[model samples]
Target: MEDLKREGFTLVNGSLGLDLKHCQLVLRKIAGYHAASVVLHEKNPKCFNNFLDNVYSTDCLDDFGPVIRTIFKNCVDMISKWPGYGTYVDTLRSLEDTIVSHIRKANERDEAMYNVLNHGDLWINNIMFKYNEQKQEVEDVR
Candidate 1:
């Protein structure tokens, strides 16, 4: 972390509204990380298997299923009351079951391709970027 700071990388200071370039840079960095992990797993399955054993599975969300469903229900109810948001509410309702099932199946160990390392929690706060001091361009991300 210190080395990253010394290299001009910083935690993003605040919300970046509609910043497509920055968003793309972050996505690219994440993609690279996943791709590298996939390659490593392919080349060294035993080591990768051992590494994955230490990581928590997404099945942990099973314990929060009720909470998730409640949140979605509340969101749908609130949004449904708003004018011109009926479509959004309907869409959310339509996808709710599918979303929950996907979450439940996400940690299944049968799919080797799905076992690659990934950022389980990706959000603005978890991302960091290096910026070119003079040009203000995104130099790197982690």
Candidate 2:
């Protein structure tokens, strides 16, 4: 907390409506992180495997399946009701099966393409920005 304060980064209060520049900055940072992890994994597969071995498994997904489906269904329904969102709603509904398959495949240890570590819970809350105080532009991301 003190480090953040010293760096002129305060926890942004209330809801943030990120503009295009903020989104681009965050995407670039995340992409760099992912690329670095992929390179590290390629350089030391054994180390990556050992690291993953100690991580939590998704065996509890069986219990959470219903909840996940319900959430997705609710999202589709809500989006469908919005004007000009029909195409998006259709695309989302169609992708439900694909999403489930991807999730399952993502958990498979044998899938080399999915071996790289990723931020599994990326959201606005998990990101911090160091802004240029004078210009109020994002200068750094953490």
Candidate 3:
């Protein structure tokens, strides 16, 4: 994360919309991080594999497609019973389908692509925001 930040990364508290400059700074950082990862994965497969774990591999799921479908199906079903959390659950179900499709496609292109060190919790609340006056936007963030 420090490396990513050094490369000009800044994460926004999604709940609080930032100025255009702030948004651009955050995007550059994110793009840099993504680019670095792709480069590293291609240049040093062993090292990359050593530091990552596949979250959506066939080994982890008996049948990748079915497992993904089942998870989404479960989410849809639960949404009906849990009215308070249903909206969130339903949204997640939609995301699950998208994520699964991406995983499947990535797997076909590069079987190792699904592996990465991911922060399991990635929600609006987990983030905090601050702005940089000199830059006229958001800068430092975690």
Pick the TM-score winner.
Answer: 2
In terms of lDDT, model 3 sits at: 0.59
**Candidates' TM-scores?**
0.74, 0.77, 0.43
Which regions of candidate 3 deviate over 4 angstroms?
Answer: 1-24, 51-53, 62-102, 108-121, 126-128, 133-136
RMSD of each: 3.4, 3.2, 7.6
**CA lDDT, every prediction?**
0.73, 0.72, 0.59
- Candidate 2, residues 44-102, lDDT tens digits: the string is 76777555642234566655666677788888999999998897987788866555555
Residues 1-142, model 1: lDDT tens digits: 3577777778876655427788899888888888888788778878775555422345556667777778877888899999998878878888666666665566556653556676778887777788888999887887
Q: Candidate 2: where are CA atoms >4 Å away? A: 50-57, 88-91, 94-99, 106-114
Off by over 4 Å in 1: 50-59, 74-85, 95-99, 106-115
> Who is ahead in lDDT, 1 or 3?
1
lDDT of 3 by residue, 55-84 (tens): 454456435767777777776787768758
TM-score ranking from best to worst? 2, 1, 3
- Model 3 pairs in collision: none
Residue 70 of model 1 has an lDDT of 81
lDDT-best of 2 and 3: 2
What does the lDDT read for residue 67 in candidate 1? 73
Best first by lDDT, ranked: 1, 2, 3
